[model samples]
Target: MGVMNELINRENVGMLAKILAEAAPGSHWPHVVAAASELDLLSLRARTDAVSRALLADLRLLPDPGYPTAARAFRSALTAAGFTGWILWPVSEAAVTLALEAGSGADPGKDFDDCLALLAELTPRLTGEFAVRRLLAADLERSLQAIQGWTVHPDEHVRRLASEGTRPYLPWAVRVPGIVLAPEATIPLLDALYRDPSDYVRRSAANHLNDVARHAPALVVATAQRWLSAPDSNTAPVVRHGLRTLIKNAHPGALALLGFVPASIAVNGPRLDRDSLALPGELAFDFEISNTGPADARLAVDYVVHYVKANGTRSAKVFKIGALTLAAGETRSVTKRHAFRQMTTRVHHAGVHALELQINGIRHGHTEFQVRV
Candidate 1:
């Protein structure tokens, strides 16, 4: 389709008719132009399935030292195509430059890490493993060098790309674990990004750490606590976000850090036996609290579940009940409904999966039951 595929600049989109008038048979201009309108004229990635695959093929054609319009077009194409698009990664570092130019947040598809893959080819990470591993570790070193130097470029977009670009899992690009399983490996890069001054860059640093936390809780917790303790204005948000999961999970340390406690618990209905009772389908709970102090109190009660995920990893999650005011000697009942339809899916292979009730985010009551799916 000649280069009609590459007219992706917001300014050039105005010239779409002239470009589309010359589309060869099977050309992707009409679709790319049409889709580009739906996505911000300068949107980050391909939006629809057909458009993604079409752009995927077109993106492979351009080499590095990309033309602006072509580079932008290639970004959408690769972004939409996702992991499948990055099959061309080793051969073209050009896409990385284009991605760097875009400087947006995460890509849209399941294969977002494809460009990150190119960085792996450019650097040596101790844990360079990724969803679809095809590159040699040696090739990644050179690419990493180029990426580091590009950090100093004047374009905020490009600078954002430097940090947002390296996430092990950039969601939609590709799912990799350069930093998730191995935090130490990504530390140097994170240090560079933490003080970046750009909220965009700082946010990226935060998200990357948050992603790492899901798989490696301890690393994220430690990192978050360290950041909270250190006196750096830029890192606070990143650290707070990183610790959010842990806080929700009722991590002992996190509860202690925030000085959170289960002040009062009021449960309605039958008190559950922790050893032999399992919530089936729909279960209900009611809570009431009495403010024992002189001043008004703000509080919350969470329903904590020891979930056995489809993959069998047991974890806890908290759902908020909002803030409440309880003047002294005032007790108000809070109603809650705990749905157990999903628990049926966790038909365990034995052992106990605990369900807990918390007041002000701390565990106060619990019930357990057997499930075999």
Candidate 2:
């Protein structure tokens, strides 16, 4: 597989140079091309920032060397279909950087506001999600006030950007400290967006809420509850996705909201197919559950694998085992085959491991097994 940094390489950088050159007839953008040579040692984000600096340098030469001039040039490029795809990553970055730099001038607020507008315009070409972070960090309330209007924006990408750009832990994006410090600040944006007609927008809204759930579980649950109370057809899925982290952690409120309420059920052996296994192998297991309660019960069945880390201390990771509904006195069996392969995200360590069952947010049986790496 190609590495991520390769996404912004020589060919694409030249494409960007050609685009910018076309956008501004008299201006040269050799600097944008020069940036590609410096990208070899940089990570994906670093490459983006480096190219952004080069782009900004080129943009500064546009008759007048400030944000208004650069903003117009960007708009002209958009009109000419000069900006699109991965190339826009650095273009958006340069726009945000210019906007922040301009914010230090006499009319700081206007620069910031204009940058937000530029981002909205650029989002459809490629997300301004990463670029918007600098503005949020610079002046959060001002940025958010502008972004709140985006929840109802005609463009779904812009609407998604409103929730996605302000996410507390948006992946591959910088952390906006103010958003983290004041988690409630962005909830209103999410409130308006969770039921968006566009699934793309709704998914971003759900992921945004999931980011918040990492640190503010109660707040996430409360917001999810409110959405559930006044749901559209897609609300349940949105809430389920938004509450995924909480669900994995087995948060009671989250579980109950999704109808995986606490129930009286009998769990049989999580019965391992083998008590010991070699590395790069598979561990098969099966379990049976019976609803012993007087009423029908819903179950969110999941498995927890307590993997032995490098330090020899086991960290528990939860894996989903699908959901089911059982009539009172009914029984069902579940089988799962878990692979013990080395992953880039997770390294296998040879030691004793344990598998446990979680049904309806409650831990059931534990079965210990040995792993030979």
Candidate 3:
């Protein structure tokens, strides 16, 4: 994974320098490249942010005295490297972000304008989703106004960024408390694009609503119901995705909105292949399920393994097995394998662990197993 990111290393920096040297021969390309190459890329936690920050620091070393000068030099290099279209997405993203990071300490009004210009030039190919958040954090009203304008932009990417950038639960970015405290701030933006013709834009709007759903479940459910109620709606996919977390957690209102109410279920023979197991072993289990209802049933089957933590307490981790549609008198058998191997994300402790069968988020049957380290 890290090897693929070699595009952000010394070699790529040299390539970018060569382009800048051509675009503006007077700029100190050699000095900039050397300074940037010396940055401790291995020390930075994330690849994109690290490479961007390195470029920003190196641009600062240029003889240019102000943010405008540095930004112009970098933008010139970007144009020289054929960054206008979606030719090199990752490269364009890193370079454009360098422009934003370069102006972090400059005047707020100027920096905001610069970021908007850069996003217009490079977005869709290289998302300004993460970069726009800085402005949101700095000037709430001004940034919100700018993003509202973006919702109707002709560019699909810019329109998507309008919703994506404001997402309260956007991964790899800090949470926006403003959206959490007053989700109404995002309603207009989401509403504007709910029926957007572009899938890209609609997906972001749905995801933004989903994030709000975590903090305001009732609001999201109501919004989804309203959208679903529209005479002609294109929001089904979006609403389904937005309600995913809620559906998995079996929120009553959410399930009712999605028409996925729990059904009566029974589990049989849910026993491990072996009651005892050692480290680096595979634990296998099989089960039988039957729907003894008068009508067909829709079931979301899952398993919960109560892993014994280091402190001797057990923590339950739910793993999805399968979903089933069973007739009134239908029966089915299900089998699954759980690997008990070493993993970076989990540590196994020796103990008897409790495992249960969950049908539509309701616990049905329990089994026990012993694991030795």
Clashes of 2: 0
Steric overlap count per candidate = 19, 0, 0
Q: Please give the lDDT score for candidate 2.
A: 0.89
What TM-score, over all chains together, does every model reach?
0.49, 0.95, 0.79
**Sorted on lDDT, highest at the top, how do the candidates line up?**
2, 3, 1
**Model 1, 1-373: lDDT tens per residue?**
2133333333344243224223322334454455445544322333223344434345444353222444334333333212232222221333333444453546432122344544433222111222122221222343445556545656544555555555666654554344444555554555667667678767777777766666776766666666667647766667655566666666666555544544543444224423343445444555556677665555544667676655666777677655565765677776666555433334433335556666555566566655443
Q: What is the lDDT of residue 163 in candidate 3?
A: 91
Sorted by TM-score (best first), the order is: 2, 3, 1
Give the per-residue lDDT digits (tens) of candidate 3, residues 172-212: 67676777888878888888888888988888888888888
lDDT of each: 0.49, 0.89, 0.71
- Candidate 3, residue 342: CA error in Å? 3.3
Scored by lDDT, the top model is: 2
lDDT of 2 by residue, 243-313 (tens): 98888899999998899988999999799999999989999999899999999999999999999999999
After the best TM-score superposition of candidate 3, give how far the Cα of residue 266 lies from its true spot, in angstroms.
3.2
Candidate 2 Cα deviation (angstroms), residue 77: 1.0
RMSD per prediction, one decimal? 11.3, 1.6, 4.2
